[model samples]
Target chain A: MERKSSDRKARAPSGAAVQKIELTEALYRALFFEWAEHGFSALSLERVAARAGAGKAAIYRRWPGKLQFADEAVNALGLKMAAFGDKGSLEADIRAFHRRLRIVFRHPVVRKILPDIYAEAARSDEMKAISDRVAQTRRDEAKKVIDRAISRGELPEAIDRDIALDFLPSSIYWRMVVIKSSLSEAQLRLHAQGTTAALKSLW
Target chain B: MERKSSDRKARAPSGAAVQKIELTEALYRALFFEWAEHGFSALSLERVAARAGAGKAAIYRRWPGKLQFADEAVNALGLKMAAFGDKGSLEADIRAFHRRLRIVFRHPVVRKILPDIYAEAARSDEMKAISDRVAQTRRDEAKKVIDRAISRGELPEAIDRDIALDFLPSSIYWRMVVIKSSLSEAQLRLHAQGTTAALKSLW
Candidate 1:
């Protein structure tokens, strides 16, 4: 059965198909949950099929193997972090980006899976390439923010773009993901300001 | 056999113990390598035993179960990041700490396992508590640095101590562990300086 049928069935008034869980989404959710629990090397396809209430053939029909499943699953997440709108100033831009990240990390599955994903990327070149492509896109987005600030005369050209990019996400990630702590809205703003100020002061 | 004897035997002239590979050390190595390949969720004790040239009972003898074994293995690594010597300047202290971190992330297994450990910490309370305690010690160490900077007249009392602590390791970690990228010595120094400047610019 085509995966898109699950989406189409959701809109239809069909009796049995309406009750069936969206096969594709259920499988994707199961994939993340299993990855969070068992990890990639030990992930069990039998269990994933069971968890999703689908047969093994159903999964193989969607993807040939685990790595292919992983690639597709991650791409579907569409991490697309490059869409931060022009917030007018570096601090505002940083704060907006931080808010976006905070939302992503708030997802229980995402938080559990993100670090492992990075670890896996470091170990497997295929995963590494996927992760690197995503990261480069985000960094390219960051470079835009830097360019805007420089053009606006809020930041000098001498400010270290590489270091500035690093500063934007590092503190927030350290606080939320690594330390598993939450900060107040005020605290978040102060940090955004701090990053802007820090970035402004250097090359 | 006591784990310490492995340490003792490392210095001994015995043919078997010396040439046979130290059981405890070998097990630790095997643990990291296995974690790197399989991840914690899929980690197999049998494979770890086989790789270490020991039996599962040997692992069971040291620690009761997977979580307990994880606790001991991580502790044996002794993160102890709080011991940065007085470098007479915040910038210098940051540079020194960055160097130490650079060394840790340079290890191949560590580069692979460190992110997973952090990911695991975010999921399990037991692991979270361990990572939290480790983080707290490092923060306390960072506090001492800020205190020194204040005393040395390099920083003001109003500087954002929480954000500064977050700043210390986040950038280097983002580069090495998260992005799986390396920075040159000059780039490392620039980021350290940027962090110091950023921290100094805020309260």
Candidate 2:
């Protein structure tokens, strides 16, 4: 059976697998950037094709339209576990989260893409879907930290876990967007550390 | 002094002052929202003229262009003191700040204008200049609170005052824009209390 199987030829790789593969991350980044810069109203197939050094038909083959392409690009930049810390303490976890947050917040893509996505989300279901998918994981990870504190009796029994999770991130973002300050390393650490302490009673 | 005042009045308000005198707060708010929504791309003499219920000639007579109008609106909406309280302790004072912040944060103008201003600031030097003017007072006020805490030994001398200020508001804004979760009264108190406790050691 092994000999026969080894001799047998396999089928060619499917289009979905091929679609998932990119020749370079740069190409992926270029596509994400163009979409973020222009948004749905201004984004065009020709422009993305030009930026990525690919033919319009190539992108069309992988994505049905600009919306689908956006989904794929955002997925490539999705949040991850390493983004937050879990060193058996809430303070450590929050510090890790802010470090990751500062990186993301300072990224040109986030500055360009986030506002447009937010504005468009108010009007477009497709964009809203993409926004929710991208944000869900980070929020969930934050909530998990709160839950762990509660489980370990590190926080008070009556604390509201969800609200506690939101405290640090919300403060950072409000300053970034509304106040438009240059975010320093010290600022990030203070926000993380201070918020962790403030909300610990809830655990 | 009376003669000086009469002479100054006889000279009439300067061009800018005359414009300010003519503009009502509601009209100012409407102009601000319109400019924020459209940027320079969508703004025009006719639109603001219509929104303000004035003729095109009236707005042109005052602002000269959308940019000038935008400049005035930016200055008009700068951070307001939402009342202050001497609550007899650092925790109470911090809590008062959060209460004021909640009011400031929830204003439709603040919410709508900020993200747009941030996005524009990245691209437009003029907007950047105007946004900085708007943001400075808020930063100063926040710093004042930290200074008060340090004086009372509520926070450690080693605490970086600037770092302490950014913690709560930044986190709150992040939750507002990214999560679309309303910052409730309960959340504000929780964040305020938690962050103050964390920084208590530094006091």
Candidate 3:
């Protein structure tokens, strides 16, 4: 019964609509899950193609290989977080950033895929180049907030902006890597509180 | 000529002296280098046997498996770091800890195996138990220094000790995971400075 209904709808959709629906569906399936069953190493061409219901040739045609697929996955993470700052209160901006980070950390794709990509990149020179780009993208995203604070004179002009930017994200990653603890909503709030207090002192 | 000379010495040595030499050689090999090479994975019967020049049976006689081997490795790290928390100043004590950590981070075992273990533990429930214990031990080591400060009354009773302790190690691990950078001597000094300032503010 389910197969009959699916086939009927699949045939009823126009070609462009079907293509759009399939693309959307494939991307959603690819990015939506815990990915715990098979972490990064399992994200081979075969597995991605099978999961996305696209041919291996189709996937390869778009992304050269695993590294490119991983890059696309990272680009997808940009969807999970929102830009913050310009709230006129540094504390509020930091709090929003932390809250958004908490949501991103809880995201299955980010949590499972990110560390694996990091580990793989550490080992493989090829992957490391792509991963470096991913890191820069994230840093630029972060700099937007920190730069806004500096323009508002909430931060010191002499402050090493690169080093200062390292604070919050470093704390979050440390908990993930060393402590192996999930970032709890309350813990994220505590970190935001501590970071806000520390940043205020920096000025 | 070198091999022949060593062969003559091997023949001339008495049984008791040969035993002493064997034990000494084993102990010498067990130091920082061995641990640095294999990491926790190297603790497997086959790898440890190959790396340490012992039979798998002999390794099994000593340690049941990798976890037991890891426990011994961790104990050595504790003993090596035991002489910390001195120099009669809070800044000095924190600086000392970072210096020791710098040495540890440079170890090959720490570089190769630690990230793999962290990644594995994040995905595996079984490994999580061991990983958690290792984390707690490191935290305990950090807390001991904090406890000493409290007794000295240098740190105020009102300080949130856990938050206070989080800064230095978190900063270092952050560099490793996110920045993909090694901790340089200058970076360690900067961490010490930041931590010292943070602790002082709490008082």
Candidate 4:
């Protein structure tokens, strides 16, 4: 009685659908690898398909072009970020956020891919929209952390959410993203704790 | 009489050399504009030369090729940064830094070109060297700030320089560059004041 195939197979994919999903996952893996190695300007669909051991038609069936492919892939990252959950206290929540960000930043492909995304966003309106969407999702997630802290009375009711948002995640980002450096465990804890103190100044 | 004409213009440039210097400046300006508009991957030397109202010979006279042109221009930026002097206090110094960075980031051409530079750094060793040189210069400047603070007893003798470095400049950069937004004067003041408190947490 299901109208479209979308809801029907999402819960339990049959044999061929499972195979197709696996193939799609392979294509994504290959796409990111090639993009990392060559930079975004040189991303090749043929190479991605060949590396994935899939036909070009497989990509076309999923995405009309490279831009569509990339947009969808980056859009899927929102789900990756949504995996973050509440960690009870403000410090714990901020620490969890930094740890998760560090894991994503530590992935070599991701390190290579992020600057390209920023460069692409600068060049094209389409890429700008994708970049904005990714940022908005992160902010939405960040808001949840701030909201929980305020409710817990760790933060005051009159806090500047924008400034608090900046305080919550920026130091680690500047360290990992701008400096292209990894943080030791102690330093990560310091970022969590230090910012927990600093965020209070926002009020 | 002087060695290779390099010392000839130590004091002054007169005649055709003056004209040549102006043309070279124009070429640098045009090169950055084209790079900002088209991105590093699509940067075109021919377009740059034409936009400057110069010929291909003008470019060849300055450098061997596009890579050399870009490298030299980026290297010249070290002089731009060297213009920053000590502001006599830690917070004033950081506020000056943020003000300088804001001016740079606000430049339409610079805003467009920076991400491409980062992306290029990721993809090419030559670019990585250039990027590292720029970061090294900034760190050297940052170190001067921390040292001044330590001497003034604003910070302790045993502060963690690396984490302190992260604390000083990141919040504004994260707000400006990563989120791609501007800040108000009070918010800038708050960043300086807040970090003055936060940097002590590293000790």
Candidate 5:
């Protein structure tokens, strides 16, 4: 039995590797809950490992320190840009985008995590850079949607893309996070229509 | 000398009242710096009094507790709406408003205090409500700008006023606080133009 165990350790079985991946994911999940509740400044790695029901060595082996852990855990949450598809018309594309935004912002985890992240970003320059990168990535993806609309002759070539890119997310975030308004679906639809109308004129 | 002092106190002298007011203002000022640097959760009334060279009892007399002190100190900072003074066209009025916004946001106290306030707001529902009230007050003031433009025939009366009121500040806050981007005068001018153009179309 000892010889067989030694052989397995030497072979590094796929089962062990899969188990390690699961452990890492569990650690990240625990970290998210901890962060959402306590924020970055108050977070403890020991608490995270304990909450994850994993050993401290497991966390240390994955991340060198707290900041990297925070960055990775937040990145793992995956706030990627939504694929609105080719909605054909600019208004339709924007409405689809808004619909996706409403869903994303309304997610239980996203709602809790976002405010904490924003608060963390406000306090730390490193976190701010990470947030800016995330925003830029989303902006780049949104630019594609606008580009498609422009190619379809739905938008003017001279449309100020930079300002337009900032508008949608900014407005949604302002309403959802800052104002903490409980926007009904109809209200969200009206916002989408109003924004689309404004974009059409500007573009 | 004690009799003379007692007689003076009985008279309720204006000079004594002025000195007391000065001390109260000084304490609030110190509290602002402390809150800005350390944040609300970490703020200490003792430290504020010490910084202001005032008595702890004085602070206690003015505010029942740290939260009220923080609220009153922040409110006293006066983020009042800018008086754009009817710049004739919507674009010009927006430009003046933008200029004032730039100054207010760039103020050292505002720059530091705003992030801390946001961080606190994320943590506390009370802070969130205070922030919302401040935003609503500013929005009410901003509505007058649009009302004036509508009256002047510069913007259409049919415009969705609610969304437009949210747009300017949301965009500015997104750029300044979330993205942490520095805006040049030229960029501000472009933003002002884009927003005005959008409003024109929406209205």
Candidate 6:
């Protein structure tokens, strides 16, 4: 039976087969739900397999371990960058970013999953590295927005980029996550304006 | 034997009371170490008792359960506002607050324990309430510094108190915890100055 199964898998038409892709999607979706519900430390491959209704061997075949599985599962959820478009002005751009942030935070899966990831990152070096890489990528993308503002003469040339980079996200994260503040659309608008004003004053 | 032991315990002098106090201290210390190493979900009274070389009954006698014990243990470690003495000027006061914050973050125990608490708070409602109460207390204390600054004419009357209250700690927390930035003394000073500048611009 083992030999026949191996032969069938080897003879599969192509590596990117539709059935395999569907199975992978099912597994990833299951893994995400498991993570959102139980968090990282409680997460196990067996649980994920059971949740996905897939075999443990199939999961192990795709990802060697839990960390690798979690990394890919989270990434597949678009955990990296917000879909930010240019709004032509610094204030508008910041508002758009904040609006996107509010939407992201409001996601049912995201709110539950992100805190788990953050907590895990705090405890585990591997998770920290993964989180740091994601943060750095996001920061780089945000830096482009600042650069555009600087070029447009909205922000002065000598403004501190490092502090500027840290401000918006940090402030928003602190309010939304740490303090658990229920900010309305108007309040978000005010926050965006305050942040942009702070940035302008940095010159 | 039980009757005789109870009779003897009832008749014990001040020495037994002192020994019990010492044992309680030892247990709390052990709990801190266990929590630092294992986080809240993994913490158990049995493990803590064994680590402290105390009996489980002794732990039960002192605190009804794990939550109470954990709460007291964390509180005993001073998970509250730091000692921020008034420095008269807005710059001096802000800098003093930052310096104290750096010291708090630098404590070996704090670095190990805060992440666990944060992680636990994310998952458990009971833990979240405890953490929120603690956060609220600290925020109220921080608000005093801002109030003083406003009263001292450093920040204008029209300044948004809410955003200013959120900015310094949130920014510092983002840098210290999220980014894990190892800030130098000079960097902290610059951060303090920039925060105060931002507060000023809020007017």
Which candidate has the highest TM-score of all?
Answer: 1
Tens-digit lDDT string for candidate 6 (A65-181): 888777777677676666576799888888877776777677666666665666567678888776876676567667877988999999889887877776667777777766666
Proportion of true contacts reproduced by candidate 5: 0.24
Give the per-residue lDDT of model 2 (tens digit) for A17-129: 33334533555677767755644445677887778787777676666677877777777775332445466877777777767666667766676666666655544679789
Tens digit of lDDT per residue, candidate 6, span B1-203?
12333565678854664235678789989998877666666677899999999789988876778887887776776777675656898878888777777777776567666655665676678788778766765677678788888889988877777777777677677777666677787667667776776677665
Badly placed stretches (over 4 Å) of model 4 are A1-23, A53-61, A76-79, A82-85, B1-19, B53-57, B77-79, B82-89
Error of 4 at A196 (Å): 1.6
State how far residue A16 of model 3 sits from its true place (Å). 12
Instruction: Return the top candidate by lDDT.
Output: 1
TM-score per candidate, chains pooled: 0.85, 0.74, 0.69, 0.84, 0.75, 0.82
Model 3 lDDT, residue B60, Cα: 53
How many clashes does each candidate structure show, in the order listed?
4, 26, 1, 0, 1, 0
Q: Write the per-residue lDDT of candidate 4 for residues A1-203, one digit (tens) a residue.
A: 11223554676676535236677778888888888777676678999999999899888877778887887776554424544777999989988887877777777777777877877787788888877776675677789889999999998998878788888778887788667788999999988877877776565
For candidate 2, the docking band is acceptable
Better of 1 and 6 by TM-score: 1
Q: Candidate 5's residue-wise lDDT over B1-203, tens digit each?
A: 12333565779856574237678789989998776555566677889999999889888866678877777666777776556578888878777777777777776667656655655576677777666655665676568778888999987878767667766567667766666667788777766776676566553
| Candidate 1, residue B57: lDDT | 83
B76 Cα displacement, candidate 6 (Å):
0.6
Which prediction has the highest DockQ against the true structure? 1
lDDT of 1: 0.76
- DockQ, 0 to 1 scale, candidate 3: 0.21
Which candidate do you rate higher for TM-score, 3 or 4? Answer: 4
Give each model's whole-structure lDDT.
Answer: 0.76, 0.64, 0.58, 0.76, 0.69, 0.73
Q: Is candidate 1 or candidate 5 better by TM-score?
A: 1
**lDDT, residue A77, model 1:** 73
